[model samples]
Target: MKNLLIAFLFNFLCLCVQGATLDFAFQLGEKQEPRLDKLLPDVARQMAFSRDSKKLIAKGMGGTVVKWDLQSRQKREISRIHAKRWFVYSIGANQLLVRDADDNITILSLGSGDETLLTNGQYESGSLSAEGTLAVLSKGDNEVEVWQLAKQGPKAVKTLQTSFPVRNGLTLSDNGQFIAAAEGTYGDGEGHRTAIEVWNTINEHPIKVFNTGEILGVWNVLFSPDATMLAVDTQKNAQSGIRIWEVETGRQLLMKSGFEAYWTRALAFSPTSDSLASGGEGGNLRIWDISEGESVIWETYPTGIQSLAFSPNGEYLAAALWDTTIQILHWGTSHER
Candidate 1:
C-alpha cells in the first residue's frame, strides 16, 4: 500500500508538471494552485524576495519583519531592531532597510544582524538597488535623495528635486542608474494621484514627465529588468491602466487599460523582463507580454493582491494578499496536493 501511494503521488506530480508548461501568468481562467499560503505576523504592507533566494522577508506597518526560508518554510522574527513604528523600506541581497517612527533609516545586515543608522533627514519613501550599493529616498515633498550604502555607511550621493508633490512611492532600477518618482497634483479617496517622472541618477534630472492625458494617475513605478523600460499603473474605480515606456526616449511602448487597480498591489516583471504580471482589486491576476499592448494574455483567481515579488531565479512569484496570507506561485511543479 505504501508503494502504491508513492506511485500515485509521483504520477500526480508528473501530470501537474505538464500543466505547468503553460506560462502560469497567462493561464487565464485556469485555477491557480496555491503553492504557499503563509500567514504573517501582521498585514504585510510590502514584501520582497531576497536575491540570495535563501530568505523571503516581509514587513508590515505594525513594525514586524518576518523572514522565512523559501525552501523549508521556516519562520523567524527579525523585527527586534526596527523602530517603534517602522516600515520595511527596502530589501537587498542580504540586507534590509527600515523607516522608523522618527522618520530615519535603519540599515540591517542579514548575515551579521548588525543595525546601521543612516541619519539623513526624514525619508518617507525609498528603494534599494539589487546590488545593495545604492538607495533613493524621498522626503515630504518630491524631494528625492540618493545615498551610497558603502562600507563606512550611507553617504549623500545625489538629490532629485521635482516640481510636484510626491504621491505614492519611489523605485530604483536594478543597476541604480534611474529612479522613478510618483508626484501628485491632487489626490482623491479611491486611490488617485498624478504623473510620474523617471530621472537619471547620474545627473539627478527628470528624463521624462509622464501624464496619462486623461483623468487618471500613475501610482507604482517600476523599471524592467534590463533597465530599458519603465512601467507605471493607475488606480481607480473603472479607470485602471498600465503603461510601459522606453527608458532612453520616454516613448510609450505599450498601454493597457480597463482593469481594476483599486486596492490591488500587483506589478512585477519577470526576471528576464519579457513579460509582466499584475493582480487587480477585483481579485484577478493577469500576465501580459511586454511587446503586446491593449491585450491580456492570461489570468487567474481574484485574490486581493496587495504586493508581489519574483524569486531571484524567476521561477516563483510571492504575493502578499489583503487576506493576510502570502501566496507563492511557483511557475513550475505541483508539490502541493
Candidate 2:
C-alpha cells in the first residue's frame, strides 16, 4: 500500500513538466486520505487549522465561526459577530486572534467565550505570529507596530516605518523577530512602483528591501515557516505572479507567473520550505518546487479559492474555497525514489 501510494505521487509529480522535473515527491501516506470538509449554509472566507492539527476554525461570510473536529468529523459554532469584513490570524491552543468589521481586534478565548480587545480603532491591516504570542498592526502612516500580546494586556514593542505607503500586504515572522509589509505608491507620471520591506523587530531597522518595479499592486506577503524566505503575490499590467526572496541576502529567488492575480492570491509554504502551494480564483491549485519553479497543477473546485494553509506537521493542506467548503488534502514529503 505504501509503495502504491508512493508510485501514485510519483506519477502525480510527473503529470506535467515545464523546465525540469522536480527531484522530490509529495506523498500521501497510508494514514490519512485526501478529503473535502463541506461547509453547508455558511460560506467560509477565512480559516486556520489548530496548532496541533486537530481542529480547523473557519469564519463564514456573514461572521459565523465554526470549529471542526478532524478526528470526530464534527463541527460546532464557536462565535458569531456580524461585520462587513473580518480577519482570522492564528488559532492558539485556547484563544484566537480576530478582527471584526469595525476593525476591532481581539483575542477570543475558546473556552469561556471571553474576548480581550487588542485594539479598538481602525487600522489598515494586521497579522499575528504563528504561535499567537506576537501581533503586528499597520496603519495609514506607513508605520508598522509590533505588539506583544501579554497575559495582562498588549504592549507596543517597536515601530518600523516603510519607504512608501502600505498599500495592502502585512505579515510577521513566526518567531516575532521580523516583520514585513508591502509598500507602494502611484505617481502622476512615474507609474506604480512597489517594494516589500522586511524589518528587524529588535532594533526597528529595515533589514531587506525588495524593490518590485512598476507593478500594479502587491496583494499578499508571507514569510516561510523557517523565516529564511519571503513570498509576495504581485500583479502587473500584463501578468501576475508570486515572487520569492532569500531573507538574508535580499536576493530574488523565484518569480512564478501565468496566473491571474484576482484568482491566485492565496499562497502557503510547505512545512519543509522546499515547496509552495497556491490557489486561484478559477479553483486551480498549484504546488511548486521552490528551487526549480515547476509545479504540479490541478483544478481543485469550480469556485474560487480564498485562502490556503498547511498543517504544522506537514500532513495536510487546507484550502478555503469560494463554494462554501474547506478542502483538506493529506500531504507528505519523501526523498526521490
Candidate 3:
C-alpha cells in the first residue's frame, strides 16, 4: 500500500509540474516601482489586501503596518509598534490586528485611527474570524483563547483546552461558528503525529477530533465558507498531502498528494463552496473541485505563496508570495483550466 501511494504521488507530481503555468495579471512590488518600495521594506512579514481587494496592507519587519491603495497607488502608515518582535497577525477590511513580541493583541481601526489593546496573553499563533467578530489565539501548552470584538472593548469569550502542547496553524470557520486547530509538538520528534480538532465557537465544545495517526503532522486546517467541510494538510516523512473532511458526516472525502518540498501553507474556499485553492512550499497553487475529490487544476509561479484571498465576487484570486509580490489570477481562467 505504501509503495502504491508513493508511486501515485510521484506520478501526480510529474503531472503537476508539467501542467503548472502562471499567467500573471500584474506584480505588486517590483524594482523601480517607487510607490511600493517607499511604503515599506521588501522583507515584510505578512501582506494582505482589504476585503474589497482595492487596498493592500503589509507589515514591515520594523513593526509597521502600511496600507496602500491600488487605484491611486497611495500609501499610508496605519500603525506602528516599538517592540522588536511585533508582527501584524491579520488585516480586515476595516481593522488591522497586530501581535507584539510579548503576545499582546492590538486592534487598530483604519477609518478612525483608533487602537484597542485586546489581549495581554502570550500566544504563538492568532487569527481573526471571517466576520471579524472573533479572534482565536494559541497560548501554547494545549491552550487557546477566543476574544470577542466589540466597539467598546474586546472580551475573552472562551478558552479551548487541549490534551497536549499545540503548535500554530489555527483556522476559523467563515461563519465564525467553528475553529480547526492543529495539535502537535515541535522539534526532534516533531511531525510524528498531529491531530486536528474542530470546536464549536458558541458553546466552546469540541465537535470532532480527527487523529492523523503517528506518521503525519497537521500543517494547516481550513473550514469551508458554509462550514460544511474541513481541509487539512498532513505531512508524513517529508511528503505532504491534503485531506478534506465533511463536517456534518465526519467523513474524509479526499486525500491527495500536495507539494513535496513544503507543506500547504494556505487553504481557501470559494464563496460558493464549490472549489478550493491552496498554495505553499514550491510556489505551487492548486485549485481543487470539491465534488470531484481530486485536484483538477494547478498553477505554479516563481515564488512561494504565503497567503491567499478570494474576492467577494469570487472573480479574482490574490496570492501573496515570498518574493514580495502579489499575483492576481482571474477565476474564469482557472475554471476553464
Best by lDDT: 2
Clashing pairs in 3: none
Q: Give me the runs in candidate 1 sitting further than 4 Å from their true place.
A: 1-41, 82-93, 187-193, 214-216, 236-238, 261-263, 294-297, 300-302, 332-337
Model 1 lDDT per residue over 85-152, tens place: 33433445577777766666888777788888877466667777877898877874958888898887
TM-score of 1: 0.79
Q: How do the predictions measure up, each by TM-score?
A: 0.79, 0.82, 0.79
Give the distance in Å from residue 182's predicted Cα in candidate 1 to where it truly belongs. 0.9
For model 3 the TM-score comes to 0.79
- Each candidate: how many clashes? 3, 2, 0
Give lDDT per model, in order.
0.66, 0.71, 0.66
Sort every candidate by lDDT, greatest first: 2, 3, 1
In terms of TM-score, the best-performing candidate is: 2
Candidate 2 global TM-score: 0.82
In candidate 1, what residue range of length 10 has the lowest lDDT sum? Answer: 21-30
Query: What's the distance in Å from true for residue 182, model 2?
Result: 1.0
lDDT of each residue in 1-337, candidate 2, tens digit only? 5534643464345433443233222311122221235433356666777778777777766677778887766788887754335564564536666667777777787778988888776677777876678888876567887888877888887777778888767888877777888888988998888888888777757888899888887767888988999998777665568889999998888887767545365788887788888876656677888887667544445556677877777777777765565666766554422
